[model samples]
Target: MTGPTVSSPHEVTDLAAVTLLVHDRTRRVLGAFLGREQTVAGAARETGLDLRVVHRDVQALRRAGLLRVTREQARAGRPVKMYRAHADDLFVDARHLPQQAGEGQAAALDPLFHHAVAREFRRALSDFSPGWGLRVYATPDAPGFAVLEGPRSARRLSPLDEWQGPPARMLSGTPTAHLTTAQVTEVQRDLILLMRKVAEFSAANAGAGQPVLLRLGLAPLTEDELRNLHR
Candidate 1:
């Protein structure tokens, strides 16, 4: 489906712009560049924010352990402090424990709580996403997250489901491939959108039975495919 525009593999989008702006525009910018590299000017231009603002945001990200800054002097320009995302610290997701809410109680609030939580999740994920597809979260590990795929970037995917997975370095933002921030953002958005739908389904099925046991998880891939990332 048509979705947010993607400018760079690491561009911060306007999906949940307000919340992305929660830590100010710079953190949002940092969100776009999580797990990669950039500079104040490069980030500013990519994220469509101000250079000064990018600088401030980088500082904040550094404090939040979301960014790791280094220096580089390209060709002949003065040395510049380059920034890369620390990843784990930049963003987060949660588990779908649903509190157990007792046995029958689970079904009672399943509908309302599902909707409320889904709405909150979307609002949170849409903050910096672009175009991405859906992967339902039917597990305690990696539930309701998306793996973004698009053109012109690498680092392709982000988590939309509750954080906590099988330690897949790539999914955990270890830069397994040349995935882009845009891709990650898209994945995250798709995740949120999918969950939104799930919540809708839950709402429709209220008072039906057994609280609809939905487990969240990542799309299954093979060892060869994952290993291919190096190639």
Candidate 2:
């Protein structure tokens, strides 16, 4: 009796993250069980795939280095294999992260992940926030961070929907100038969605805390504006 294999939403997203070289449902399914523990029957049930099908996918993922048998058991006159997600094979953390251990690991995978996330976010905006503008910006001076600015006119933002996991702030700034209630709320919100979405891509789910998004607000000041604001 082989333990079951299971798939998770996080696993599904991981496959999408590193799909540049390969895109197969089996690989994705197998990646789900690599580092994490799972039983074959459980994985079959979770992924809504047949036991035989899941087994095949697991085998395929092993060959790809996306999955490996972490453990095995014997019961009912047969041996059962337990699958764990292989660290090397996973491409994305549900937190929008790579499995690498470090601060700002997301930055390491940014060139690739950023484009994909931006594209998904843009597509999401079309239906979720029609008429809203999403801009992707990176400054040489701003290292280990990525920012997405929505149209200044947008309303409240909800990170629960936007971010795949919890997000936390690394650094935050206050808006130098007082903004209208709508502007204030909108800026505060969309900023949260974008950053929190980015934060979750780290090590949170794997003993990392539940994803928390960090919100930063800045009001860029002109020379004269700065004088007035200070006064």
Q: Pick the candidate with the highest lDDT.
A: 2
Put down candidate 2 lDDT per residue, 1-231, tens digits, no spaces: 988885453343544335421445665576457557888787888888888988877776666556667778988877888887666333354365444434354456545544555655556555542344454544456584445544334344466423331132222233366567788778768878877766666645665654433334455456787788679
Residue-wise C-alpha lDDT for candidate 1, range 46-107, written one tens digit per residue: 88887787777677667655567666766666677777775423222223222332445556
lDDT of each: 0.54, 0.57
Worst 10 residues of 1 by lDDT: 164-173
Q: At residue 122, what lDDT does model 1 achieve?
A: 49
What TM-score does structure 1 among the candidates reach?
A: 0.30
lDDT of 1: 0.54
Displacement of the residue 192 alpha carbon in candidate 2, Å: 12
lDDT of 2 at 97: 41
